[model samples]
Structure formats: C-alpha cells, structure tokens
Target: MDMTPLLLAEIQFLASFSFLALFMALALALSWMLLFFKLRVRLTGDAGWTAAYRFWVRIFALCFALALAACLPVLAQLGSLWGGLMDKIGNVAGPLLGYAVLSVFVLKSCFLGVMLFGQRRVSDTVHTLSVFMVALGLLLATAWMAAVHSWMQTPDGVAMVDGRYQVYDWFQVIFNPSFGWSLSLTVLGAALAASFLIMGVTALQALRRPPGDGERCAFKTALIVAVLASLLQALAASGMGDVISRYQPVKAATLAGYWHSGDEPELILLGWPDAATQTNRVLLAIHDTGGRWLGHDSKGYLGLDKFTGPRPPVALSFWLLRVSALLALMMSVASVLTLMRTLRRRMDLAALGLFWRKVLVGMSFSGSLLVVLGWCVSLVGLLPYAVNRSINLSDVFSQATSSTLLLSIAGYTALYVVLIAAFLGMLLHAVRYGVVPVRKTTGGAA
Candidate 1:
C-alpha cells in the first residue's frame, strides 16, 4: 500500500507547473516595467530614465538566471521520478540533470550578456540582433521541453533495448503527434502574453499624461504590432483543434464538453461538473445540447458515460477540458475586439469599454493560473490508472526510498503559497502606486 510512486509523480508535476507559472508572471511584470522605463527615457531624452530602465533589466536578467538555475534540479528530479513511475530507465537522471543545468546557465547568461551589450551602443541593428538572439535561445530551449512533453503524450520511435529505453530517431520522438501544433500554440501564447503586457504598460503611461509626439509615435507602432501579433496568436491556437481531435480526442472532447465523436461539435458554455459522477449537469439554455455542445450525436454522447466507470476520474477531465477551452475562446475574442478597436483610433473603446483593462489583467492572470490548475487536475485525474499499472506494493515501496517524495510534495505546497502571497502583494502595490508618472523634459527627443 505504498502510494509513493503515484504520490511523487503528482508532486513533481504540480511543483514544476507551479514554479513555471510564477516565473512567467514575474517575468511579464518585470518586462512591463522595463518597457515603460524605456518609453520614458525616449520621451524625455533623460539619462535618468535610461539608467532606471537598465537597472530594471539588470534585475530581471539576474532574477531570471537564478530562477532557471533553481528550477533545473527540480526538473531533473521530476523527470527521474516520472521515469521511475513509468517503469522506464533510471540512468537518464545524470544526462538530463547535466543538460538542464548547462542549458539554463548558457541560455540565461547569453541573454544577460546580450542585454548588457545593447546598453553600451545605440545602433538599432545591434538592438534588433540582440533581441533576435534572445528569441532564438528561448525557442531552442522551448523546443527541447516541447519534445519531452510530446514524448509523454505519444511516445514514438522508442523501444526498450537491453533492458533500457533506447530512442530511435530522436527527431521522430520530437516530431510526434501534435508536436507542430503544440509548439506553434506555445510560441504564440508566449508572444501574446508579451504583447499584451507591452500594450498595457504603454496604455498606463498614456493614462498618466497625454502622450508627447515621441511617446505617441512609439505607442502607435507598438499597438499595431501587438494587435497583429495577438491576432496571429488566436489563429495559431485554432490550429490546435485538428491535432487534438485526431490524437487526444479525450482531451479535445473534455475541453469542448464534447461527449462524443462526430463532425463539427458545438462548444459547451456552462455546465456543472460532478467529479463523483462523470456527468455534466447542464446549465443555461442549450439549443444544441449533445450534438453541438459536446460535438457528438446521441450515440457519441454515450462515450462520455464510458469514461466514468471506476477509472481515472472522468469528472476532473470534464471540468478541466471545459475550462481550458473556455479560456482559450474568451481570450481569442478579447484579443480580436481589442485589436480592431485600437486600429480604429478608438483607444478608449478598447481600453475603457467593456472594462477591457480589468478583463486584460484577468485574462493574463487566468491563463497562467489555468495552466497550473489544469495540469494538477489532470495529474490527479490520472492517478488511478497509474496505480493500476503498478505490479505490487513492494515494488512501489522500493521505488520511493531515497527519492525525496515527501520533500517534493512539501516544497510544492510552500511554492504555491508563496506565489499567491506574491501575486497579492503586486496587486496591492500596483493599486497604491498607480501608474508611473511621466516626466516633462527640456523639449522633445532630438
């Protein structure tokens, strides 16, 4: 009755996602500040703003470096724990740990160096190159992580050789089912987050004072790019459907509240999920209940019932699947409408109307939160299956020793508590300080 393997797997997954969400949110907030400082520097032609901006970036660079450094060991442990639970090889811990540490240091230090290099000169080309290089490094690292995740989903081109898992054509594993769509969606989501933050910071500056010519010019340019990028992100996300439907139908159906296999499922709007019973208590009006809402006919809808009998909990799947899809739809609509209004010279319409400011913030925070949430629910939801796969209690008991199972779980709990505190503190500070004040300068930029 040692539930150590299952428990450890759950702990590692939860901890990794919790840390990642916190890191991204912090990074986004710092990016917003740096962008604002940079704008002030350009508008006033004052060295003070530039100095502040550089300092902020320096702090960001340092923090990101440290955060990544700390995550490497945890990530290694998580991989090892997951592998052991899956009955995979154990020797992967060494190579993976080394790679994780090396990748973080190399990537973070290189980006920091690029930022420092850009500060000493004023060439737009140099700045552009620096940004490009940083983007490239991030993409490479992301590709690696994506490969690992994709392998977890559809492990292709790998076979157990001589009692060890040997990867055949690593590229095949990397490009497994849904890899393209997943990678594209991930990159687009990152860009969307970055763009939204940029727009928000710029808009906050506009609210503080009427924009000067230089500020106005920069804001206009950024708005166009951000809006376009956001639009592209939505389109890219739509591409996730085909892949999801083909390979991960269960996930797709759950997200859409689609209870069946069919052509063109209608999305579910409001439904109360019962974890104890794999039934979605319908809420609100439903013109197309089963067919359109769950994307399945009467027979297809019955498939959902099959998912619920004494196995990995179907209730969580139903809930998370719906939540993730719902969030995606909401963000897509918000991004499009906001962009259209901004382009029409109705900044107020986009910024003020429909409580867009609050909505924007909510969307950003919710997106990050849901990622962690969905991951947790999914892992927990899968626990029963994992338990079923195990040989016996003795085998499981042996795996948990020296694995630091309880420690990982405790660490995850602590990290999440700290994250909530940090989030609240930021909100309070933002409200108290308000937007940064714009400085009037001796004339405009030369």
Candidate 2:
C-alpha cells in the first residue's frame, strides 16, 4: 500500500472530529452555565442575571448549530473512509453512536425549544426545569459518545467471532475501564473551556464599554467555575494516566518518552523522539519522577521496548502530551491569579489592568484548545489500531484514491474554516453590541 490515501483519510477524519468535538464541548458547557444563570435569575430576581442569560444563550445556539453541522462530516467519514471498521465493530459501535444522536435529538425537540423560546410564556420554575432537562440531555449525549470512544481504547466485554465483535456484556461495554475517566476528563475540559470563554468575553465587553453589573456577575461566576474545573481536571487527568498506563502501556511509554523498562523513567520535559534510532535527541528531562507518576516501583514499569507491535508516531504523541500538560498548568495559574484579583477588586472589571485583560482574552479559548490537543494525543497515540490491538488501520482504511481523499479533505477544510469564521464574527458582534431588549407582549388572548 502507498499509505498516501490512508494518511489523507486520517487527516480528514481527524480534522472533522476535532471540529465536532470542540463545538460539542462548547455547547455542553454553555448548556450547564445557562441552567446556573437561570437558577440565579429565579432566586435573586436580578435583571443582570437575565441579561447574562440572554447574552450567552446566543453563543450557545451558535455553538450547538456548529456542533450539529460538524457532525455530518464525521458520520459520513465512518462509511466513506473507514467502511471496513463497521464490518468488524459495528455491533458494539453502532448502537452507541445511535444513542448519542438520539439523545441530542430528544433534547432539541423536547427541552431545548422550551428553554430557549418558552422563557417568556412559561413560569420561571417551568423554564428552570426545562434548562435542567436540556443540560441533562447534553450530559447524556456526551456520555454516550465518550463511551463509544473509550470502548475503542479499552475494548472490553466483546468476543470476536466470524470477523465481528459481539457484545457479551452490555454493562462492561458501556462502562469500559477507560469510560469513566474519559467522560470525567471530557466534561471537566468543557467546563474549563467554557469558563475561560466567559471570562474572555466578559473582559472584552468591559474593555469596550463601562463594566455593567451583569458583566461583573458573569466574570466572577466564571472565575469561580474555572478554579474548580481546573483543579478537578488535574485530578481527572491523573486518574486517566493510571487507566492509560494500565490498558495501553505502549501509548503510555510513548507519551512518557520511555525507551527502556525501569522503575524510575526519566520524564522528558523537552526532547525530540527519533523512532528510527529509538532515542530522544536534543533531550532535556528529569529522572526519578516516572515511577511516582506511573504508580510503579522496583522496575515494574514497561517501556517502549516491551512492545513489539506497531508504535505510534513518537514525536507527535510526545509533544502533544507535553503541550497539553503545559496548557493545563498555564490555565491553573491563570485561574488562580484571576481569582485573587477578583477577590481583591470585588468583581470590579474596570480595576483589572489591560495586560491581565488581554491575558484573559488570549486564553478565552484555551479550554477548547486543550480538548482538541487531548483528543489528538488520544487518537494519535492509538495509531495503527482502530480498535486497540484488534483492528489495525491498514485493515479498516478506505480504498479510496489519493485524489478523492485529497478533494474531500480540501472540501472539509474549507467548510470548517467558514463555519469557524461565522461563529467568531457572530460571537464578537453579540459581545460588542450586547443583546437587544425584546418588548414583552402582554394581554394577548390565549
């Protein structure tokens, strides 16, 4: 095989999946935030909270729309690019995908309309319940999708027979060893991303005009949420490290840049991995940390040499994991600093200096960036296998010509670029101008 077409197909699928995942995280985070805002409105009866809800709802709608739009390419690619994968794992994967899709549809058709458009017609309590339902729907959808991907990572409860995977236990399949950790990390990542997005937009709004009560409330709330989410995300990442190391040691070794099995492996802080030589050139690292991190002792750790199967692209996995870790650290620092400033200034956005404001704005999308990078690491690290050790990419990759693959990639790239631009344009416009006041129509004959 030339490998060109397969490479192109991988690129196309990755691009599409990354786009979808980013928007999905945004939408999921925003949905929960909306519920919180709605509850604040009901309890405090503050007009500012209402203003905050109105402002953010627009962004949520935009994110949800883009998420849906992004889904089509991913679904299309399942058949168009990796048709053979379905032949092997469809019994396990098909129902999970359907559940994810159905959850979204149920939310949109039932609760989303009430949450979005029924705010005026329904009572405050009713509207709040609708928001809660919508949030639950989003959570369920995320869980199902995470279950599908996590199963691919661990692949339990399935017996291979006649070239197909059949589920022997639904419980094990749904809650595969990695599923809980994956879901926790994903949801926390979304919350963190959404918090930063709110902080950044609020800061932008403050910079544009005099800071309002609604803006202060939103900024403070998001700051608090960011702090909590970042802390929880760190813990979740640590837990996920255990899962990955246990189930996917090769990926763990690649991510840690470990070449030889030992109790204490050097943690590569900065290096370039050369697979051809199986060494790290231009190395900068610290030793004696891997044992503690991997929860191993006395030469219990397995390294890259322990695996004779196909290895992932070493440099890509190594750097992506490091970059994501660096981003998480930066976000933690930023969150703490913002919290201190918020406490000192008492939610006064105007008191925050321009430098800090710019930092917030720059990091507004950091959560989304972290999510994408994390997904890239997960997918890339699982390379050559569509389903762990069972189905290799060579077996499932499309037979499409390189030209056709290239054309589809180009088309998807263009489409995503436009969608992203539109999202940014609309979001900036909304933040700058703020929401327009709608006239409450009263005394209508029902």
Candidate 3:
C-alpha cells in the first residue's frame, strides 16, 4: 500500500537512518579492512587484499557520496516546507556538499588509478595515502551533514526577520545546541563500527583457517581493538545523554519515557511501544536519572514549548531509546566475547562462533532499526521548533503530483534495497573468496 504524508515522513526518517547505517557499516568495514591489510603486510611482507579492499571501499564511499547528493534536494524541500532555522544548513549545505562530492570522487579516482597501475612497492604507499585522504574526506562530510541534521533537534540563535530568518553568527549556526557532543558521538559510533567489522573478519578468518599461533594472535589483537572502540562509543553516547534530555527532552523522554519534567529521570528497559495509546509496557526502569546528563537540564524539558498540542506522546521516545540502547549493548557484549575467545586460543570456538552468528543476525536487524530511529528523531525533532516559524502559503512541492511522489518513493525504495542486497552479497562473497582475489592481479582491479 502507498504511504500517507505522515507515513511517508516516517519512512523518510527511516530511510535516512537506513542510509546512515549502511554508509557507516560500509565505512567501518572499509576502514578496518585497510588496517588489517596494513598490519598483515607489515608483519608478513604481503600486500594481500589491499587492492580488492580499495576497490570495494571506493564503490562504497561513492554510494554515500551520491546519497548525500540526493539529500540536497530533500533537505531543500524540507526547508521550504518548514522555513525558519530549518533552512539555515540547507542554504549553506549546497556548496559545501558539492565540494565534498567532488572531493570524494577525486579521491576515489586517485586511489583506483594507483591501485590498478602503480608498481608493487609504490602501490602500497600510494594506496595507503589515498585511503587516508578518503578517511579525512569522510570525517569532514559526516561532521558537516551531522551538524545540519542535529541542528533540527535543538535549533539555536536564529532570529526571525519579517517572515524570514537572519542568521546572526556563522559559528553558532554550525555549532548549534548539541553540536559538540552529537558530532563526537557520531564519530565514535563510526569508529566502533569500523573496529567491529575488522574484528568480525578476523574472527571469521580464524574460524575457517586452522588455528596457528600467528593467526590466533592476530585475531586476539583485532578483537581487543574492536572491544575498545565499542566501549568508547558507549561512553560517548552516555556523555551526550544530557544533550538528548535537555535539548531534546522529547527524544530523551521518547528514549527513556520520563514523565513530568524533574530532577531525576529513570531509564526504561524493554517495552511494547503503543505510541497511539501513549502507554509503554515498562519492563524495567533505572532510578535517579539526574540533571543534564550531557548539558541541558530541567530547562531542556522546557524546549518542548515549541510543540503545538499536548506535545508528542512520551511513549514514542520511550520505546526508541530502549531499543537503540539494547542493540548497542548487545553488540558490545558480542565484541568482548569474541576478544576473549580469540585470546585463549583453546580452539573451543563454539561460544565465539555463536557470538559471530548473533552479530550477523543483529547487523541485519540494525539496518531497519537505525533507519526508523533516524527518521523519528529527525522529523519529530523538527516539528517543535518549526511550529514557531512563519507559515508558507503553498505546499513545498506543488508542481509534483501524487503519481510523481509515488514514483519517487518507489524508485528510492528499490534502489536502496538493491544497494543493500549488493553490499551484503559482496560481504558474503568476501567470506567465501577471502580478501585476496584468487586470480592473479588483473587490469580490472580498478
């Protein structure tokens, strides 16, 4: 069935999250793959899969690059529809986005060319430099886009001027309210994802190949790195709890379901989300959640003033927070377990194997969950602030028909599904074929 406007908005939120997760997963996999290749080469004096890794990495990076390009139009339309501070980033984002896309493409071309044609010794060095360049580009692009997105949750320092907005400070625009913590959390999350993939591959390799001392040590190291990265990511998210609560109480409350703003909020565990009925089947609630876990406080609850009627039901935020947190924690445990198993080198691989199996399953589920979370947070986060803005007379896309909208929606759905399928297919192929191409290096390496 075709989705309604509300449903479509939800889907857009879900789609953005889905895209972000895919982008992050691909990026994480690519980063650790490079690191693994580097370590192996340094230790054993073999470039191994560096060439194939670059090929896949470039393809993956290009996908996100294009996805960001596509978001430009979507953000523009959203800005026109919402107006006010909503458009601030979109206005500035166009040129910045253009520069980013061109930069990524250029980096990809440089890496692809070097990997394909450069001599053995030079190729490794050139490939390493190219990958570093791409990493830098990704860091910048993710930060910029995240700033634009997180701004929607806690808009600040924007003044209305005769039905238009006059942004007073450029730094403030970029900084927004939750700028620092949000950016940090995203970067940490990306790093965690990268480490997880690396260790995951390491673990898989160890399982398939007979246990040798060298292989066991390598697996242990990868798992430790992944575990460390995952822990830091959790801490980063926790550090931002105050920001989510104060600047985004609805999100906080939705995440944890704390009612009637006060000194301490309890954290909820598992629950069925009946947002329509405004009731969460609370499985567990922690005690004494206090002021400004990230920054904002009781005043953060006040930010809900931007909403029109009764505010969004608290249940929505309640369920989302619990689910996202649970998945993150489960993944963390799996990483730690993998690390422990690899270290013992006892060859009793059943436990670690189960953990890897869970991860693969969890990874599949996380795709949709993250998509839903992204959409919910982005869309609902905007409503409170936009309600205070001047109204536009016509709908943003008046020229577009229902048919056009459907076609647009359907096309995106198909493309992303195919993109996801292709990515998973490649991942499984890597498992089957290993990182080093079985065939001798060919001209088509690019």
Q: Can you give the TM-score per candidate against the true fold?
A: 0.68, 0.96, 0.74
Best by TM-score: 2
How far in Å is the alpha carbon of 7 misplaced in model 2? Answer: 1.0
Q: What is the lDDT for 98 in model 2?
A: 93
What C-alpha lDDT does candidate 3 achieve relative to the native structure? 0.52
Global lDDT of each candidate: 0.50, 0.87, 0.52
- Highest lDDT scorer: 2
Write the number of the candidate with greater lDDT, choosing between 1 and 3.
Answer: 3
Clashing pairs counted in every model: 4, 0, 9
Give per-residue CA lDDT, model 3, range 314-361, as digits (tens).
555555555666767776777676656545654233336655644643
Better of 1 and 2 by lDDT: 2
C-alpha-based local distance difference test score of model 1: 0.50
